[model samples]
Target chain A: MNIDPVKALEGKVERLGKDLKALDSRLENAQTDAAHEQLGLSNQLKDTTRKLGRTNDRVTELAESVHRLERLLVALNRKVRAGETRKADFGNWPEIEKKELAKIFQGQEAYSRKTFTPQEAKDTRKAIAEYDRRAHEAIEAAESLTHLPANAESLWRKHYKQWHAITDKHRPEVPDDDTHAKDTAAKSAGNEAIKRTRQQIRARIEDAVANDLLFPAWFENAMGPAAPPGRADDWLYTATDVVLYRLLHDVTSPADALGPAPAEDGHRKTLYDRLVSECAEYRRP
Target chain B: MAADPFARLADRQQSLRTALRALQAAGPGSPDFPALLTTTNDEVEAVMQARRDVEAARLTTPNRAIAAGTTAAALIVAVGWFDAWSLLSLLVAVATAASVLVDPAGRRLWEPRARTTVITAALAATLLTPLLHGWATLITAAGIAWWAWRTQR
Candidate 1:
């Protein structure tokens, strides 16, 4: 019995479209997951910026306080050096010193009306000085976090190389272009449809992963439950790695145009660098 | 200005125009070229709008301190002529003070070089009493206000 080739081809194309439509749903789910993760990161960055602004204000206040304290101390020392007071008055000088120190803590608006015992002023100054020191340390830490985007990029690169190796394992070599040209059967509409469908799936997956729109479900399904203390970063490594590997593995021969191949390690590094650079917009300036 | 986002958007706009032109030249028959060209044009417009938004966001509203500073500078230079606070001088001060205040960005309206020039002119004007020194200061203040307005644009 002779089979109608075009009719059979049409049936296959219809089935292929249905499969791709299903894959599209999964891609959407992944995209949603990535978007949520990005939102969390963005919120965290904003929080850090707010904290930085407050810290800057505190630093300014501390500097101002120190200046005021120095002036007060100089005035007190000048009065003492003038020898206008008797030695008997020296015992009560500490009380005066305490009052002056306390006045420094009270803001200028309320300073004249609000009375502070010498003891309270001394204690407040000590406490505020300690707070200022801690604030400086926090500012240092926040400054260091400016490098967080670079760290994320490096972590992603490491996972991508691992995924690439795993996916490449035991895979059949793709047939060469000359061989494909000779095999007319391989160039049929069915093959072309399959190629186009595959390209679309690959692109959607890459877009979802590259833009960090991939949901945790994409990673959890592949990597199992993430190790405890699961941050968005944990899934990020796996989701992007999977997408990158699939993208590289599914490309047509002409698309393998990564220029000349290097040593295996060098080739992976080149690809990693290229992929990281492509996603530079997501990274810090 | 060094980290201005609008400047970057403007640069993107130039590149986008070049790309859109190339795609448009590909003609309508080519599959995807029409869609690509349309998308590129949309992106260019988006960038242009964003640049405009950024410019609008940073638009310098008149600042009271700037107006006050201008009047103070005017008075400082006018001190030698009429009564330092003569009716005419004070009126000029009040009127100029009522004028728009210019906020600082990039080089300041009262930049060091401008400050030195104004101070030198005022000092020289002091030698010619009658407090005609008002013109030099008035002119200097006007120059600064002009510089600031230009910078904001």
Candidate 2:
């Protein structure tokens, strides 16, 4: 008896289809079991994909954040190295003075209410729609068939074959002559452009975080804080608060927005920095 | 003014085109893309979970209400109109009753992934299952009341 690989693959596929069907009925009586099983899986996959996207977005966004902090770190490092600035300079941020940071809460809250571009709003809607579509497909698939698409290698192979074949087909044909140097140069150029965009955002943070500089109009637009009529310190602290506040509330947690948390309340620090703070607050062994 | 306006317009168009091309480079299914897709996927799923929570919440209430309504209707018919509730109607009523109890019971109790409280509630429902038809009504009321209190607070 000849067992062809293709036939074997087909056999596996047929078996999967059959098993998936059987899983359907048994799963029905244990219906919620089956339903949620798919729901969780699909949601997980969808989430993983979305998370992957958001991670990319947040990373990119926070790449801006990182660059901002890095520039602050760099400038602070440079200042201390030059003996031109001290740790006291960081403490001098207007945000450090409670009254100064508090002054900008009004502006930051106003910024929060500001409408996102049609694109940003559209993206949020798109994320939601993509999630719903994939989630429904996952739950429905789980209910209809048992051979999990996620785990079924043979079926997945087939799925990959059918859906994953687009790359070669759509890929722009490379010119015969090598463009590696050109491509590398172009990428380097693009990287520099990205770096500049990043640094623009970061320069402000460095200004606020390290140098205690405040340009009210630019500060308000990018970092969301207006300078008090006379004090630069208020503007600086306000910027820090706005950035961190946006990270904690709008970007991460909605629960923080709901009611007074009272304990930690809406106040949270970066995990990395929080660890540092905790260490500072601890009694020495 | 027209030349200045046209130059500004041209520059704006060039900038807008540059931004769009950048986005196309970054769009979904873009090769070697960052993992933001996965985060978006998760947030999407969380949203989906929120939706499921709503549906699950709906099922828990309406289903038990269905049992309560049927039982009330049966009693009314038995007392007001019919000599006795027909066996067919009785079976449907019992099935509905069982369904009401079973829905949340399955979700909260029977589900392998059920939360501890839901599992506890399910276990409580199970212990009361022998008197399920009537007990289902009480349990549902309690669950709903608990939900309302928690939500309202």
Candidate 3:
């Protein structure tokens, strides 16, 4: 053992060197494997970034389409709402106009009467002017809402013109002996004109039906069906006129058609009653 | 046979007038005047009720012949227009008539202006059909007619 110490030491050193060489080779192999794994991870990271970018682009495109769809829906909703509003306005116009005309008529009637004092006459004229202004406003409001039937507006204008003419022609303040006579004549003439106008309207309705231009559904409903060829009743014509007046004026109540003053005439009272009943019947569901 | 409501009403009115005259002649101071006045008022009321009954009866009983005739006439006119013009024209005419028939009060047809527009357009297309000839013209006419019909409905 004493003789082999140097050789043994040398052999141990050589074995230690060989072991160090093997550990160094293993470290190199591990670094190479780590480098290959790092490259693969880097490629995966790039692929993930690319997919995220595409996802972001697709999300942006979807958002833009949704925005466009929202705008279209908003526009369509607005159009439908506008149409409904217009229809509602048109439906409400007749009653509003009727109220305004009633006020005007009351004023006209007050001024037309012989019982009014000079001061009362003046007050009535002022009131009539105010009523006229209000009627104009109502008409303007209706016109702004939607286009009304031409005949409806024209008939109103014609009635107003006649009423204005009658009011202007008779000044009760004038201390003339014939002032009462003139007023009476003017009043009678106005009544006659109104009667003629009503007849004309009725004739127009008949003509429109005859020519197949228009059908008077309301009229037919109010007045029983048309009479037989030779069995035509007189009451039918009167009833037709009354119904037409109510329809044209949108008069639903007897007071509106016959005025607040009680009718002393039986025939007039009957007519008004019939009108009220017919209008009610027609309006029933 | 049913009693004539009109004749009954007239008789009641005559009786009321006679009682009124008698009451006037007797004067308000007379003891019988109150009874006469009451009787007269009763007669007036009776007459009014009779008149109302007659009117109610008349209003309910419509002449079926006239209604049928009107509808027939309208159909005939529509059919005649169809023969003379295009189907669109006939459609417009019939639709207009049907609207009146369906809603006699014109309550359902809220847009009179739209109705007028459709009717005018349909008429124009029908009228222009005879004046124009060619595939393009026919297509245009057809388009206009279809547009009118679609818009109206």
Candidate scoring better on TM-score of 1 and 3: 3
- Model 3 lDDT per residue over A132-242, tens place: 454344323322212222224344334333323322232223234455565666556545545554565556545433333322334434443333234333434554456
Q: Point out the worst 10-residue segment of candidate 1 chain B by lDDT.
A: B103-112
Between the candidate structures 2 and 3, which one is better when assessed by lDDT?
Answer: 3
TM-score winner, 1 or 2: 2
Where is the poorest 10-residue window by lDDT in model 3 chain B?
B105-114
Chain A TM-score for each of the predictions: 0.24, 0.19, 0.29
Off by over 4 Å in 1: A1-285, B1-66, B75-97, B102-134, B137-153
TM-scores, all candidates, are: 0.18, 0.20, 0.21
* Chain B TM, per prediction: 0.33, 0.39, 0.38
List model 2 lDDT by residue over A70-110, tens digit each. Answer: 64565445555655432222112332334333333433333
Report the poorest 10 consecutive residues by lDDT, candidate 3 chain A: A85-94
Reference-based lDDT, residue A270, model 1: 57
- The 0-to-1 C-alpha lDDT of every candidate, in the order given, reads 0.43, 0.41, 0.46
| lDDT string, candidate 2, B1-153, tens digits | 123433333343344334333433555345532243343333333322333343354345644555555555555543444322233343444444554555542332112112223333433443343345344445534544454443342
TM-score of chain A of 2: 0.19
Candidate 2 is graded, for docking, as incorrect
Q: What TM-score does model 2 achieve against the real structure?
A: 0.20
